[model samples]
Target: MDKDLNSIVQKALLGDKKALESVVEEVKDLIYNLSLKMLLFPEDAQDATQEILVRIITHLSTFQGKSTFKTWVYKVATNYLLTEKSKKDRKAKEVSFDEYANQIDTGQSAMIRYTNNEGEIGLLEEEVKVSCTHGLLHCLNPANRLIYVLGDVLDLNSKEAAEILEITPSSFRKQLSRSRERIKNFLTAKCGLVNPNNSCRCKRKIDFLIDSKMIDPHALRFANHTKRSIDMMQKIEFLDKTLSVFRSVPIIGAPNGIMKEVRQTINSITF
Candidate 1:
């Protein structure tokens, strides 16, 4: 795919209209998924994806071929995400892992006693599970969060991920280890999905999540999409079974009308 993308990128740099559109089509989903994991909000992810695509198109001429086109795209996208001030403001709302865990435990007692008349509690449970896990990721600062997303969620190797982040391989491995251990320790102590003995269950938290407006039953985000099964994940011997919860998230696609919007942006560009 990178070989074909590199050829198309070359044509795109030379001002081929179809090649530009193909470039957008090929990388839109990748950018959107990465953005979604980073932002944890679908709307924010959509906006970031559009901006990143525009940056990629405008900077197409800067490609030096030192890396594959896909890796270059990741580098561009990660740079935008890392430095965006608005995104930094969003991260400001993040809570510490201990605070988040305490909230979950406390909320379990305040949970409204409601009945699942619509028979949708199952879906609601899934939403709570996904939302809580995504929220947990916010405990990490942006840099560490990016590392976790790249290494664990996206399954990028340390060397490849280091190149994208422009860090040494050893630094990347060390940071990834720290991030993974932090998450592993938290999940082991709190998440019932990761440890059956843990008291926190998704079903038990749904009422509180809904009552607190943490999740909207009417507007289901992550749960409504098709999720990747655990079996589909790469067989990495070192990956703990508990961490599969993050890898099993649904891969969100670019929003409708994105292609049209991207094409308009491309047409407006001089090259």
Candidate 2:
């Protein structure tokens, strides 16, 4: 997609309609793919894609080349999709996980996942599927999820991900870490995914702080022994069921561009 956007953006900005059209053609697939990942509905995704293209055309003049054209275009597509999602959520109660699975339409496409060189370890194919679905939903509300998908799953560099999100690279990393924790928590609760390495790693860190007297042992005691809380066993069982939903439902199918089209259509035309 980046390869496709280069000359197209340069030529399009130079007042070449054909070049601009070609650029759209090149990135339309990407725009829509990401949109569908973000929006999860073909109609919504299509609108978002079309609207993004129009915006790209309008903003061509303002694209100062601070980032690649693909980055700018991605921001356009994702930002619009996020806005539409927020608007809809504000209008009504949000969907539950089951609702998300049952209501969503998957035409056999899968979300690309990222793997660490540490290898699969405890994560099996089924685990990946559950994690992806849970992660996508975790990210659907904030555009941050898409950013992680681009950065983590796609293995895009921080600068590239930052460019797409319109945030500083450092900021992108921070949010990405938070997003990772968020998805992990979501999955842990949904799939009984202990992620022994990661969990034990966290436990070790916590223990280190305790042994070093960095944390208040009293607080730890209260959190674990004093307050009534969901037992670890129950939590694991809950997450296992949650993870099961993805195996049954599937995630990472198609992208939407409907909002993109609408934005393009409704906005004032610009060169």
Best by TM-score: 1
Q: Residues 94-167, candidate 2, lDDT per residue (tens digit)?
A: 35455433322222223222233222311223232332353355444556667656765455788888877778
Give each model a TM-score. 0.90, 0.53
Q: What does each candidate score in C-alpha RMSD?
A: 2.9, 16.5
lDDT of the structure predicted as candidate 2 = 0.52
Residues 122-204 of candidate 1: C-alpha lDDT, one tens digit per residue: 67777777788788888998899999999988989998999999999999999999999999999888887667798887778
What ranges in model 1 sit over 4 Å off? Answer: 85-88, 109-119, 228-239
lDDT of each: 0.81, 0.52
Clashing pairs in 1: none
